[model samples]
Structures are given as structure tokens and as C-alpha cells.
Target: MNLRANERLSERIMPRPHRRFIFSTLLLCTWLFIAGCAVDQKAEVDLYRRVLDGRVAATQPYVEGESLTLVRAMTLANQHNEQLGLRGEDYLQSLIAKNRAVANFLPTVSFQPSFTIEQRARDGAPSGSTGSNTTASGGSYQDSGKISYRTEAPIVGSMNLFRGGGDIANLQSADANIERQRLLLLDAQSTILLNVAQVYLQVLRSERAVEVLRNSVSLQEARLKDVKDQFANQLATKLAVAQTQAQVNGTRATLLQAQSDVRNGRHTLALLVGVDTINGKLSEQSVTDAVSDPKHTLTDYEQMALDRREDFAAARAAVVSARAQVDAAFAQYYPSVSLNVAGFLYREFYADASKWNAVLLANVPIFSAGVIEADVRSAWSRLRQAMLNESFVRRQVLNDVRTAFENLDAADRKTAEFEQQVQAAKEALDQARAAFANQLAINLDVLVAQDQVLNSELQLTGVRFDRAVFLLDLTRAIGVLPEVTMQAATRPATLPGLP
Candidate 1:
């Protein structure tokens, strides 16, 4: 009985011809709201998943205070890195912008209830007549001073059928922007990876440098002591002892500087991994291959980078988005159509403007004081800027690949030269030791030959370190650092052009 009464009340309140419109509009709005919420929820899930991964990565299998690996550093950075987290927020913002663009192509519903008051019939007939207007013959008795009021409560809904392609363009632009942010995050990841690896390797390299210089200092000290002993025996000159002391001082100075570099490298690594300090031994891992040669040719690397580089792809997407904006701006020159409907719940002093009303509104732009023209021109300017950026990024991608490829080749060549130098130094050192054992050469000659051999090996090691850094650079330039390293900087691509 209650349900039937409610039906009759609804039918009486809104004409049967339009009652379904009210229910359908409500459902549409509800669905749209739910969809928007779902989009937000999805973005949240994605962002925090990386955060979780970073936390989990911190729990490594290595013994505490023993080593910090590249994998561990990257995972921790992905979570704790403020800059990357901020970029993730940018991704969320783009999602929201897309939501706003979507709303343009959807309907809106609102409830408005209002009350009004008015003064009526205040004119007096002949001021001296004295209340004659309030006589029995007077109608409505306005001279007696009365008030009038009105009330209306309505549920309104509106939907845009067409405007310009601006809605779709804005949507496309938002989609492109999302890709751009994601690619930027990936690029940042690769860059941070390079920095961490460099710093980590540098710390180890500087430590090795310190060790080498310390050994040289020790050798010089021993030689200086021998020179002092011989001078006391009147076998060596005082000048020889002074020169050996000078050599020891110089080597010690260099060793001090190398130790400083090691400390600085540790500080940099700590900062890069988003920690206050890296408080432990860093396990060494070689990032180089035994045979350092590009599987692909130089030309191939250049072309491949243009395709694989995330930033370059992002720049291209920006151009597509900007072009869409141009079309959207042109859309403003066209007419727009919309539908507005209202269902009045109750009314006072509005019996004639009764239960329901609807208006199909169309706005034709005959003139706008050059506003649309200005908009179109501005959009075109933006498109031109995007195109220019895309070109610069394309060249940059090619250059990165070419530069790393060439540098690796040079390092490889240096490797050969340094190896030969080391071999020759070792042969000389052997001859010096043999000659000294036979009493044919002085102790100073043997010390000098050993120093030369040590320096040669150090140079060879340096060449190998340079080869490793260049190999890592080539990996980064190709935009596969995360992939080849087995660490993820981003999720799967969301758009068509992204790979």
C-alpha cells in the first residue's frame, strides 16, 4: 500500500512522460561518481605498491653491516626517494586531470531549493483620502500593509551533447601527460641508478687508490731508511737521503687525498640511497663485460635509443597532446548543445510553473571579440614549442647512444695499451731484482723498478674501471638499466605509444 502511494505521489509530482528521466539521470550520476572513485583507488594502489617493494627490498639476505648491493640501493631509493615519490604524486594529479576532462563529456545533477519575498501594490490614492483604499470596495487590501512570499525546491540535471572537440582533446592531453610523467620517473630512476653505481664504484676505486699510494709511501720510506743507513756508513750521499725523504712526503700527500675521496664517495652514496649514511662495507660487483663491444653497430645504437629512450618517447607524446589542444581550441569556434531538466518537488505561489520542466539549450558563437582566434593561436604556439622539444630530445637520445658507444671503444683501446705497459714494467722489475741479487745494481735501482711496476698495474686497473663505468653508461643510454639490472622503476605502459 505504501509503495503504491509513493508511486502515485511521484506520478502526481512529475508527469509520467518524464518520470523515467529523473531515475535514469540519478543512476548515471551515481555510476560516474563510482567510476571516478575507482580511478583514484587504482592510482593509490600503484603508488604504494612501489613503496612496499622498497621497504621489502631493505630486508636483504646479507649480514647486517656487511654490504649494500646495487639492487638493495635501488629498491630502497624507489621507496624512500622524495623526488621520485613527488613524481608519483604528479602521476596522480594527471589521473585527476583526466577525470576532470571526462566530466566534461558527462552529465551533472544538483538540488536547489529557494524562497523569495516581495512587496506589492504600495501606491496610495490621493494622499488626503486617508485609508480610502482600504475601504470595503478595495480589492486585495494592499493599503493595509501585507507581505508576499514564494518557495520552490527542484532537482536539476544538465548534460552537454556537444561543445567542441575540446573535451576529447583535453582528455587526450591528460592521457599524454600521464605517460610523460611516467617516462620521466623511469628516466630519473635510470639516472639515479647511474649515480649510485658511479659513487659506489668510486668509493671502492678511491680506497684502492689509497692502498696503492700507501704502498708507494711505504716503499719510499724503506728506501729513505736504506739511504740514511748507507750515508752513515759513508757509502751513499746526504743528497740521496734528502731526495728519498721528499719522495715519501709526496706519496703520503697523494695518499691523504685518495682517502678523502673515499670518504666523500661514501657520503654521496648515502645521500643517493636516501639514507643519512651508508654504514657498512660495500660489496664490489663488476658492471663490465669481459669483451666490451656493442652487440649492435653505432648507427644501430643511435636509432635504437631514439625508440627505447623514455624521455624521447615522452617528448613525442607531448607533441601529440599539444596537437590535440589545437583541435580543442578550434572547437571553440563551433556551436554547443546541452540539455537541462528540472523536477520540482514542491512550490508556493508557482502553481503555473508546475511539476517538471526541461530546456534544450544551444549556444551559437556569432562573435567573441577575437577570443576564439586568440585561443587558437595560443594553442598553435604551444604545439610548435612541443614539436621543438621533441626534436631536441630526439637528438639528445641519439647523442647519448653515440657518445657512450664511442667512449666504450676508446676505453677498450686504452685497456690494450695499459696491459702492454704493465707487462713491460713487470719485465723491467724482474731484471732489476735479478741484477741487484747479482750485486750489479744499487738498492735504489731495484726500488725504482718496483715503483714503476706498481704504477703501471695501477694504471691498468684504472683503465678497467673506466671500461666498467662506460659500459654502465651505455646500458643507461639505451633505457634498459632497470630491465637489465632486474629492478623495476615503473609499471607496465598505460598508453599505446609507450613500450
Candidate 2:
């Protein structure tokens, strides 16, 4: 019953018709402002599509199941890798930050219209007293208290006229952060390309291993058949047949493991390329046929890395951002200034009432209980940390160059050794076959030498694969993966409102 009574009371106090018009005007102004400033999702998506088309390489044929080439695999990874896409968001947000800093220089305007009703007892009146008080609008009430109305419809605005150069420092800091994010995005693209290439080579290596193992199995089966024929003619013992069958079984097991490695390697490559599975054959030409010596010395590679590495450039940008933050923090020791203005749309008629008014505000900071000092110290520490990180990144870049160069060098040396070993095994196999034809060597000797030759060839293939992968690694370590894979480096990303 009391709730019903309150509802009836509220209905009786519905806004006056003139006040409703004022409310509608405020609503319309707010809607217009929001509509003008809001981000359009469709436009943003279109922008993304256009920019992405120019940046990423096309891999339509590869995605539709063309055989997996390393170059195509890299193209697919650049288009579809989830982590690389996530890194792109950082670059996008940095552009938003750039716009936000730009907006700090603009004025903030709003419509602030109020229609307040006050119902209170008279001054010094007892609690729950029924006495009335004169209202602001000159009204008298006798129910439980006085009733009054106060209304205002004003357009207000404010702008930061000055802030001890802090605004300028903040804008500079934001610009530096933008450049840093762009460089990091480039680094991410290079990283993904190198990863895809590594996995692609892994699949190639496993496929080659499987091929070598299959060849070994075929040779072993041929020998087994020959031994069975000898046993049937009473020229070989049953124990000899059993021994030959055991060797064939062992070779089959090794062949199965090699086949499994091929499948597993392909699966990994598929995931890196963002595909559900990869069951196609890799190009045989992907194998390294001949390896050459390093084209540059270790010192030369190190210098290239230091000059071309994107993460190092990003680290240097971080130091600049930190220094700007320090300057902004110190600016708190100076004064700030701003301007505020208001124009009344619904003004009360009075002899001294003004249509509009403006006030200039200035704040001089004399003391802050050490708050400003603490901020300065924090900024200085961050600046120091950024400087140290830049130095550390430089060291790491050199280290990466040296490590990759050394690994490639060692792999090249092993290629020579493995080639010699393969040649010697082939020579031994030839001599053994000749001796067997002359009945001077046993059949088992000839078969054993042939197996040695095949094994040596397999080892040589593995060394060549290693050399190829390490060469790509050296290219990546020197920060040239983008140049080699995509034929161009990723450019700085930009968006709407970016300067």
C-alpha cells in the first residue's frame, strides 16, 4: 500500500513541459557528439584488409595444397600465424595512443543541464517536522517540508593552456613508443619466417632419412633371398638362414622408425604453417646439393646484426621514451595553466545575471610532501633500466651472430669429412664385389661392404641437410630473413589519426 502511494506521488511530480524540451535538447547534443567520435568497426575492418594485402605475401596456391616449398610455407605463416597476428595488435594500439596524445591539446566541451528538486524541513526544524521553508523559486509548502526547484542548462568547455611542457613531453614519449612498436612488429615477422623455414627443413630431412632406410631394407631382403636359395641347395646351414632373417627384421624396424620421423616432422610443419595437417611430398630440390664457405667473417656478421636487428632498435627507442617520461615527471615542479568557459542556455532573470563567463586557471606547485621527488626518482630509475636493456640487447645480438656463424662453419667442415667417408666406403664396396666374383671373398663380405657404403651415403645426406638448415639460421641471426624470404622488410604500421 505505501509503495503504491509513493508511485502516485512521483507521477504527480512529472517534469514540466518546458523542462522536457531542455532534456531532449541535451540528449540530442550528447548523441551527436558520441556518433561523431565513435570508431566504425566496418571501416576499421576494411582498413585492416587493405593494409594486410600490401604487407603479407600471397600464398593461395600453397594453401590450396601445392607441395610444401619453404618459401610458400613462409608465406602461409606470415598470413595465418596466430602469434604474429597478436603482435600486430600491439602496433595498432600504439597508434591509438598516438592519437590520444594528440587529443590532449584540444578542448573538451560538454552540455551539463540539471533540473534538481529539493524537499527539506525548515532551518533548525526538528526531525520529521511539518514546518515549511521558503524555496529558491519562491514556493510555500505545508505537507512535511519545503519544496524547491533549481534548473540550469549550460554549455561548458575547458582547454589546457599550459602544463610546464609536460604535455609536449608526453606527446614525444608516445611518438617514440609508436616507433618502438613498429620495429618490434618487424622483429616478430622475421621470427615467424625463420621458424617456418626451420620446420620445413626438418620435414625435408626426415623424408630423406626415410628414403635411405627404405633402400637399406630392399638390399637386406635381396640378401635374405640369396641365403635361402643357398640353404635349399645344401650350400648354407639352417643357422645361417636364421641369422640373415634376424638382420632383415632389424632393418625393417629401423625403416619403420624413419617413416615415423617423417610423419612427425610433417605434423610439426603443418602446425607452424597454420594448417590442420600436411601429407604432401616436399620438393627434392630443397636439399642442399653443395655447401660453400661463409661469405663473411664472424666480425662482419656481428656488425651486420648490430646494425640490422630490429629488437635492438626498439630497445633504443625505449630509452628515448624513458628520458621523455623523466622530463615529464620533473615538469611537476613548475606551474600549469588552463581555461574554462560556460554559456547559459536557460538563465535565471536577475539584474546581475551574465550570459557567459570565462576563467583562466593557474596552479603553482610549492610543495607535495615529497610526491614530486618520488616521481622523479621513479622516472630516473626507469630511464636507467632502459639504457641497461639497450646495452644488453646489443650484447645478445652479437652473441646470436657468432653462434650461428660458428655452427654453420662446423657443419661445412663435417660435410667435407662425410664426403670422404662415403667415397672410401664406395671404394671398399667395389673391391669386395670384385673379390667375390673371383671367389676370393665370401658373399657375406660383399654384402657387409655394400651396407657400409649405403650407411655412409645416408650420413652424408644428413650432414648436407644440417649444413642447409644452419645456413638459413645464419641468415636469420644476421636479421636478413625478411630480405631472403619475403624479398622486403616489413614497413612501419600506421592507422587512422596517426601523424
Candidate 3:
């Protein structure tokens, strides 16, 4: 009986132990897999950070002047203006031309050496006295003047003259071109900065919109739960409950769209900030202020354009360049005077010694097949075109200024109106909620109030964002942005006309 009992115990205990061991092994493998996954996730996160170096770098250095706002980001982009490979290539080419221009003003020198060797003999006798006295019958004057030597020396100098100032004009043109590129680079920087700011602001607005929408959804969800509870208690009708549920579902769908907008806005910001095209994170400003409307006088705006706009300066420079080109064209009609100097040493085997010769020359062009006339015509046409373009840009800039100011004034008023609307809507929602709590209003009434509140919130957000956008446009129109070495974006303290 004891042996039988022991066998039974062993059978049960051995199977149980094997099962426990297998289970433990499986759990261990699973844990290893989860741990490995966590490590990989961390690595991917780090890789994304590395890819968005520009955005990350923008926020670093512990924050300096103006806290490195989006405006400063624009300035930074300008300072770090890079256009794929074109800008660098342009810079390099300009540098080469500049170096060549500098070299042209310096002296030019060269070295040359020539030698002549030959074996010669006169038919009867050599031209010298000794050769004439030699016997000619001795095997056809066996005196072969086989002389060979090398002349080792060099001569070098330089000369400059009045060539209708063509070289000067060329150098001037190069300098102007460099200036033009510099201005263009400034313009590029401004554009990139504007893009970054716009995208960054969009992301901020989208995020806020998402948060506000989420709050709305939560509020609706709470109302839906209350309506369901009331319907169960027969205090609220089924229709009212169904309406609340439908509203909640609709809010959820809208929430999804807002989230998508946020994601896309962040992606756009990443692209503008030079963030890697791959996976990257976007950092944005956290601003919660009422958008304000500001008005600027026309005179002030025009002054701002003249003083701070790089485009205006560039246009003016173009006019100067056109005038210079006209001068260069006219200069072609004049004669060019160039002084030339050349020196050489000549050596011959037949001569007793080497000979040296030096010469100076002057040249002028007295006639041409109307090439100068054609050039003058081209230059005049260019000048006229440039003048027209300048006028057009100026008019456009002034119009932009006027439009921006008007928009700013309008945005401020709209923001104020919307702010009032939002406040009234909030009050209405509160009253409806209170009435429903007291059983004086149905669930449908409360849901409608909630929807109104949500709509008002959305409207308010849009108005605020538009105000900001208009402000940016106004600043740009006045050309105050590019002239600003640093950015100081002033967030308004309160809504216009708000207490």
C-alpha cells in the first residue's frame, strides 16, 4: 500500500513540475521580446530627434535674446540661408570673379627665352676675314661654322592704359552682381523665415483647436451620459437621449479631422524649419492670448517700406546698375588707347654674340560696323525695362502696405465681435445647463447649447488665428521684418475691446 501511494504522488508531482518549467521558459522568452522592443523603440525615437536637428537646434543654447521665437527663427534662417546647392555655387562663382577682378588691377609679367643653333659654310669662303683667306680647294672649304650655344635669360613687365574703362566697368558689374546676390540671399532668408513662422503658427493654432475640440467632446460625452441616466429613470425621453448621442458621435468625427489637421500642420512646419524629410518632431510656441487688431497710418507704413525693405534697396540698386550699363554702352563709341611694351634677346650660332631688342606701341580703333550702336540700343531698352519693373514693384509694395493696414483694422474689429459672440454663447450654454439641471429644459435644449458653444469656440479660434496672420502680413508689407536684426513678436495681452 505504501509503494502504491508513493508512485501516485510521484506521477502527480513530476507532471506538475514539468508544466511549471515549460510555462516559466515561455514567460522568460516573452519578457525578452518585450524588452528588445522597448530598446528598439528608444532607438527609433533618437533617430527621429537626430533627423530634426534644425528645429531642435533652434530651441537650444538655453534661450538667448527674445527667447528664440518664430520671428528669430526667420532671422536665423536668413543668416543660414541655404538653397540646396544653388546658393553655394553662386557664391563660389562670385568669389572666383572677385578674385579675378582683383588680379586685373595688379601687374602682369612673363618670361621668354629663345635660342638658335646651326652649322653653315659659305659657298667659296665664310664672310669673315679668316674664312676669306682660307683655301677653298680643300674639300669644298672644309670650314663648317658648326657653332651651338643656348641663350638663357628672361624679360618681364606690365602696362595699363585707357581702354574706354572697359575693365573698370567689368569690375563694377561684378561687384554689383555680388550685391544683387547678397540681396537675393536676404530675400530667400525672409521667405524661408516667413514660411517657418506661418507653419509654426498654424501648428499652434491646430493644436489649440484640437484641445478645445477635445474638451467639447468630453463635455458632450458627459451630457450624453446624463441623458442616458435620465432616460433610464424616465426623467428624459428616448428621443432626447438619442439626439445627445448623435451629437457626441458627430463631435468625435470632427475631433478626428482636427487631429489630422494638427498632424499635417506640424509636418509642414518640419519641412520649413529644415527638419529632415523623414520622421521628425516639431516644437511650437505655447501662446494663449486674444488676437488684437492694430492700425497703422499710411505715412508710417510708406516710411517703413523705404527704410527697412531690402526689395526697395535692390530695386534702387538695379536702377543704378542700369544707368551704369548705359554709360558703358556709350563708352563703346570712344576710341581705346593701350600701351604695349615688348623686349626679346636673340642668339644665333653664326653671330659673334646675342642681340637684344625692345619696342613700344600704341593702338586705337577708328571704325566699327555699328556694333556700338546696337549695344547702345540694347542698353537703353534694358534701362527702360528696369525702370518699369521698379515702378511696378513700388506700386505693388505700397498697395500691399495699404491692404495690410486695412486688414489689420478689420481683423481687430472682427475679433472683438467674435469675442462678444463667444461670451454670449458661453452664457447661453450655462443657462441651458442650469435649466436642464432644474428639469425646466429638455436634453435636446442642452445639446443645442453645447453645439452652439463648440461652434463659437471654433469661430473664436479662427478669428484669433486670422488676426495673427493679418499682423504678420502687415509687418511684412511695411518691410519692418527684414530690417529687424532680431524678432520680438509681441503677443497681445487681451482681446480687442475685452474687459
Candidate 4:
């Protein structure tokens, strides 16, 4: 009895037609909400998974106990540098933009489904008639209530018929942007390689300086001992023993500084190569051997730089993209035509129907408060800016090529001069030591000779390293650094002077 009473009460509150319409609408809304939540949850899960994977990868150990050669260093820098990775991501984004440009030529389709329930009331009673005579006369009579339900499902599609070649222009612009990004990536690679070479050479130079200072310290210690023994025999004065001891102390200090430099240089090199520590011994002789004489004239190198430099190329591509933007802006002047097709389904208390329609639309802009004109002007201005940038970059490239060539030439000359000085200093030191042992020269003369030898050796080491570094700079200025292959475990490529 209670169930029957409840059923009657529910029917009175909501008639059958109204209840059905409400139920259907609620069901559709619930399903759509659930589907949207599922999609969002799935995206969240995938994002978390990627984050976890990145954390694991970051924790993985890098290669250890491997020789860090110049080529290997460059390879690792290219693979692991954050800046290069960002450049790659930019390139990928440009590709996505290109895809979007292509999609503009395809038809767009969308669906809109709706359900509505409405309660309406109407009065049928004349304006001047009495209550019972209102229906008899040509006047409004009684009031009646009506409930209506409406349902519609329309699938609409539209395709562009004509847009004054704007779509084509946009696609071309996207292509130009992609090319620009590629050139930028190449530029970054060259820069990173040059940096690696510089730090690697520095490490070698510091290590060599330490070795030379160590030898000098050992020689000074022997000389100090000799002077002390002569003093015991009263053949050498106390002043001579003290002078020798001072020379030994100075040599030891210089050695300590050189050792410090080696440590700092190695740390910097390891950072550049994206490793925990740099593990290989850098060969000073190998670095000197790798210095090659410049084969081309400055003019030739300048030409090469202009041709191969990625910055110049990217600038040119930017101009092309800007020009495309101008063309796209001009397309707004012409009429745009598109074809649209739509279908609908409706159900109600008084009507049930289905309908389909197709439309051809052409929109021609007659006035726009100068909006289109301003866009064209803005695009043209950017194109002009790009052109000016291209000119500036060309001049800069030429200047860089000439400057690097001159520096390399100067380095070569200095290296040769230092080599001669080193030989002369060695001869002077040998003669001075012999004379001092024979008591024909003072201990001060031996110390002076030793100082000359050390200075000459330090100068020679500096010039040799400078020569190698200048050569690298020359190659980088010419935009022709040797390419290193990126791989899981990269092998060193053939450097300019390496077999």
C-alpha cells in the first residue's frame, strides 16, 4: 500500500512525458561528464609516468674510466647539454606548427546535441467580453497549460572553397620557420664543440706546466744540497747556501700553483663534457701535433663562413617567413568562400522531425577600421627588419673569419720564436752550471740561468697551447667544425690532424 501511494504521488508531481525527458537529459550529461574525467585522469597518469622515467634516467651513472678526447667531449656535450635539448624541442614545436598549417586545408566537423523541457501557459479570453460569453464571442476564453520537449542532434561540417591563397602562404611560412630552427640547432652544435676544445686544451696546458715545474724543483733541491756541502768544506760562503735555498723555495711555490691550475682546469672540462670527472691524460705533444696550418686565404674562409654559418641562414629564412606573412595579410582583401552542411533531429510532445541543410557562404570585408591595413604594414616592417639583420650578420661573419685567421698566424709566429728561446735557454743553463761547479762563476750566475730556462719553458708551453686553441677558433669561425655522431656510447671522430 505504501509503494502504490508513493507511485501515485510521483506521477502527480511529474507527468510521464516530463519524467522521461528529464531522465534522458540527466543520463546523457552524466555519461559525458564521466568520459571527460576519464580522459583527464589518463593524461595525468601518463604525465606522472614520464616524470618518473626522467628521474630514473637522471640517476643512472655516466661512463667512467674512459678517455675524454676532444671528439668524445664534443659528442657528449651535444647529447647532454640542456641548451641543445631546448633547441631540439623548438624544432619539434615548429614541426607541430607545420602540421597545423596543413590541417587548415582539411574540412572541420563538429556535433552539437541538446535536449530541453519547457512548461507554457496560454489564455483564451477576449479583451472586452464577459466570462461565459468570451468563448462564444471572438475573444479569448480560458487558460490552459502545456508541456513541451525538444531534442536535436546536428552534425555540421565546413570546407574552405577559396581564401585568396592564404592557406598556401601560411603553409610556406611554417616550412620557413622549420628551416630556421634547423639552422639554429646547427649553430648551437658548433658553439658547444668549440667550447669543449678550448677547455680540453687548457687542461693539457696546465698538466704540462706542472710537469715542467716538478723537474725544476728537483734540480733546485740538488743545487741547494751541493751549496750546503761546499759550505761545510768552507769552499762556498753562507750567502751562497742561503741563495740556493731561496731558489728552491720559489720553484716549489710555482709548482704548487701549477698543480692547482690543473685541478681547476679538469673540473671545468668535466662540466663541459657533462661528466662527473674527466678521466684521461691530455697529451701536450698530441695537441701541438693537431695544430694544422690554415689552407685557405682569409677571403676564401670568409666566403665559407657566409655559406655555412647557420645564423646567417636562419636570418634569411626569417625574411622569407615574414614575406609570407605579408602575403597572408593581403589575402584578407579578397572574399572568402566556404561550404557548410548541417543535419538535425528533433523530438517533442507535438512534433517529431529530422532535417538537413547545406549552405555556401562568401564573406567580403568592405570596412574594418584599418585593421587589415595595419596588419599588412606590421608584416612588411618585420620583413624589412629581417633583411637588415641579414646584412649585419653577413658583415659580422666576414669580420670574424679575418680576425681568427690573423690570430692563428700570430700564434704560429710566437710558437716558433718561443721554440728558439727554449733552445737558447737550455744551452745557457748548461754552461752556467758547469762554470759554477768549476768555481769560475758565482752561485748567483747559476740561479739567473735557471730562471731564464724556467721562463722560456713556460712561454713555450703557453704559445703551443695558444696555437692549438687559435686553430680551433679559426675552424669555428669558418663554421666547419668536424661533426661528431651522437650515439649511446660515442667514439671519437677524426680530428683535423688526427689519424
TM-score leader: 2
Give the range of the ten consecutive residues with the poorest summed lDDT in model 1: 489-498
Instruction: Estimate the Cα RMSD of every predicted model relative to the unseen true structure.
Output: 9.7, 6.2, 25.0, 7.6
Clashing pairs in 3: none
User: How many clashes does each candidate structure show, in the order listed?
Assistant: 0, 0, 0, 6
- What is model 4's C-alpha RMSD? 7.6
Worst 10 residues of 3 by lDDT: 132-141
Error of 1 at 137 (Å): 28
For each candidate in the order shown, give its overall lDDT on alpha carbons.
0.71, 0.74, 0.60, 0.73
Model 4 stretches astray by more than 4 angstroms: 1-62, 117-147, 238-242, 283-294, 345-354, 484-499
The local lDDT score (0 to 100) that residue 55 gets in candidate 4 is 17
What value of lDDT does candidate 4 attain over all alpha carbons? 0.73
Q: What is the per-residue lDDT of model 3 for residues 1-499, given as tens digits with 9 covering 90 to 100? A: 9998987654433334444544565576688679866635455333323322322233332122223345545534443334512443454465457678667666565544433223334443444322321223221112223322233233555555555766676577667665655554444455565566666667667777888989998888888898888889988888998898899899999989888987787556545544433133333442222223343467777776666555666676677667667777877766655444434433222244324434454456567788888998998898798788778878877888788778777887988988998899889989998998998987778888888888888888887777676676666666544333232344443212211
Better of 3 and 4 by lDDT: 4
Write the residue-wise lDDT of candidate 2 on 1-499 in tens digits: 9998886555334335535766698789888989999987766544333333344556674544557766667778777777766766777777788788888899999888766566554452454454434445443333333443445677899999889888889899999998888778778887887777777777777778778878877877887898799889987668767876877787788778878888888888778788888777677544233223337768777877877788999999999999999999998899999999998786433223567889999999998999999999999999999999999999988888888888888888999999999999989988987986686877677667877877788788888878878877776677766555544223321111101
Q: What is the lDDT of residue 371 in candidate 3?
A: 83
The true-versus-predicted C-alpha distance at residue 217 of model 4, in Å, is 1.8
Question: What TM-score goes with each of the models?
Answer: 0.79, 0.84, 0.69, 0.78
